[model samples]
Target: MAGTIQRHPVSPVSALRLFFVAGWRSNLALFRWMRPSAFIPTLIGVPALQLIFFVHLGRYLDTQPVSYYALGNALHACAMAGLFAPAMSLAGERFAGTLPALLATPANRTLMFAGRTVTAVLVGCSSTVVMLILGSVLTDFRLPAEGIVPISAAILVTAASCSAFGLLVGAAGLRTREAILLGNLVLYLMLLVCGINIPRESLPDGLRLIGEIMPMTHGIAAARQAFTGSGPVTGLLLVELGKGLSFLVLAVLTLRFLERGSRRAASLDEV
Candidate 1:
């Protein structure tokens, strides 16, 4: 009994505190490398410019209403934070030579990585709001007073879903240096297929199927419906929520699998 070590379960409060602290630190580390000048442009300016460009393009083509492009691109902008942030944060640990130390800790691995998504979702929502405001000011985009709550909820869900998918990209980064590249690839794929600029009906069946299973499709649809007060939004929102949960599960499983493999091979920090 003299050598016996008693293991105590982590209290709920302690777990909550750990989740909060991990999320806060993860967000800080995410932008620590950038100067304010670069950071501001990357976060706000790039997305704003993107929205402006596409809105004008849509106007030139004379295909859809300005609100269509505005809402679509604004939702798409969520990925700038939702996808890139988590991938960079997780993969950055390897780049910074800290993954080994992080893995050596006694904390819950899932909680630690998952907490990082909180800030990502917050930043994503902020990005969405900024895009919406810009759309309203620069174009004919308008949200009815009653439509605000549903649209806001749809944005939050979409960001969470995108962050979940980003975690999967981050998990892959555990072993490779191409995580950012992969994130960019997925982002563009979503842009092309997920009804951001072009309507889903315009896409080929194969691409439409791909978009159906992806994150932003349903959320974008739900938000659009909410804005117009046309169709039932609850169904779309539920499907979006389901997509997020699926990605979240896959990310956690992929992370755990990679973590085990890396630990077994003594390659946790090899990137």
Candidate 2:
């Protein structure tokens, strides 16, 4: 046994702690929106302004009730936190010159990256709540007492789903510098196709199909139904959860694949 070392496996509780600690540190390091100057405008001011714009636009068009736009845009605002934050978190490691060090660690790649989603989901849910409150105060948006629980659940699920999708974009950032650009592209694409501003029924068949498979569509529908207390929300929530899981799987796989390729090619530090 001379000169040999034995390593004990980490306990479950310790593993959990490591997961959270790594995630928190990753968020602190990579997610710049945590700063007051960035946080205020990104999470609060931007979403609030977006809600106001859409609410007034809907009023001018006189197409749908104010609640419709309010709920839709509020749900969409969650993406600002859920999507952009996580994408930046992973992609930023490369830009910060930490990717090589990160890869050199003995941590579980999946858990480390997935843990980043925890803060993203929390921030996203906060953004959703803020948008909802602004909608209620500034517009005719109202959530029935019975609908509150379901709407809250929908918001949480939708935020998680958006965070998962963001991880996928971050995975791509391992290979290229366009992760943030891709995140913006997907965000606006969802805005148009995910029934945020316009009805999916009005979109062409191709765009409608795209929206169907995307993250926010079902969550937005579930929230709207919850807002009105018109129908059962279980199905929509389940579908939204499924979509999140799918994106999470894809992101993990993509991260692993890229990590291996970079190691083989000695390119982890290349950018």
Candidate 3:
């Protein structure tokens, strides 16, 4: 009798059902939160300063399509920070004991993570749009309808991968405080090094290798091609596709495993 207990069987989430999980809800909340925050100004603020700075120093590097950099940075603003936002937010949520409450619900851990990742990508993309509008209005930069669909698709996929990477960070924090520090460090570093401000073309050979590992590199490469129409689109899109899916796959397998470990270690509710 002690071992034998009556229990209600729970239903497995259908593929469609997984789409509506807490992760997505959390992602939406992030978007809603952005409205009140200075989302637009925050995104374009530095870049606006950049445009002015460059304009003043006119003869600097007209070689590269500086106009193209504006749109590229829009994608950067959208896809860049995402590599770390999920993990950083998760760390905060775990520390605040919010994760336990969310996990206790029927919403699976992976789904919750997925939703947050999507939210991060959305925020990035939204920020880019804001920047794009501002840049278009203020400057003569123009983006085409042809590039729009591919760029959007690329950003979405990059978001999924970064979300997975974030989960990796969150899980690492479950092990030690050092993980949080490292996670935050790399997150910011990725923002700078992964061809966000400086172009991949400009980075030293060593750092260029590091850039290749970043999801942003692949996505930006595709998006850049989409913007310029100078090179073959297929190859860039293929690279972007591989990186995005690789991250998603890794995030799903790794986070779910880490979720189990975190629960067993009693770290889930600890913060």
Candidate 4:
């Protein structure tokens, strides 16, 4: 009995059930403990400032600077929320002594992680919408009426991609502090290379290549097209969705590798 592992059958319905219950509780706990002043600044203020500063600078050079910076920074805000918050939450679980119990449970860790992503996506989307509204008011930018559905789809894809990348970051954080640092580095790199402020075409060949693979690059492009009603929204949104799902698969593999390598009775320590 002591050495035996009690494996429960994997059920899709049960997994969904677990995800909803645990995910909601986790989000509530996060909000309850984090102070409003500190949380608001990180979630909204920092990204808003970035939006304003870039838009102001772009005004001098581009005729449609408002459109570029407004949408770009909105996606950037979503990326920050989706990428950092979830990773930090997972890392917090480790420090809080919940990681071992969580891993030991019969529930699938990957599904649990996905469940947590629900909140990440919601928060990311909410942040983007707030920025878009605020930017429109202050900068005289107008949201496209025709492409509302496409824009919404684009936001969801962006959130999905960033959250998938966050899973990788969270998994890595289980091992070292350097992983969280790496997440920060990736965020800034996205801004530079992912056409957040500068066009991907002008990023030099090497950086341009990097931007193509970054999560928000295609998503931002799709969002922009949706905003301007300029390009084929379905194709771009689908591509962005594909990228996000691919990252999620990679994160799953990474998590599986870490779990497999975990030692007996010291499983969490090994991870």
Highest lDDT scorer: 2
Report the Cα RMSD per candidate.
2.6, 2.8, 4.2, 2.2
- Give the poorly placed runs of model 1, Cα more than 4 Å off: 1-8, 33-35
Superposed Cα RMSD, model 4: 2.2
- Point out the worst 10-residue segment of candidate 3 by lDDT: 2-11
List the candidate numbers ranked by TM-score, top first: 2, 1, 4, 3
**Which candidate, 3 or 4, would have the higher TM-score against the true structure?**
4
Clashes of 1: 0
**Model 3 regions more than 4 Å off:** 1-15, 27-35, 38-63, 101-107, 177-184
Clashing pairs in 2: none
Q: What TM-score, computed on C-alpha atoms, does each candidate reach?
A: 0.94, 0.95, 0.75, 0.92
> Residue-wise lDDT of candidate 2 within 1-271, one digit each (tens)?
8633354477788678767888888888776555799788878898899899999999889999999999999999889878888899877888888988887766677777888889989988998898999999997678899999999999999999999999998898888889999999999999899999999999999999999988899999999998888899999999999999999999999999998887788776766
Residues 175-226, model 3: lDDT tens digits: 5555567655765666566765567787788888887876667776777777
Candidate 2 vs candidate 3, lDDT winner: 2
The positional error of residue 215 in candidate 1, measured at the CA in angstroms, is: 1.0
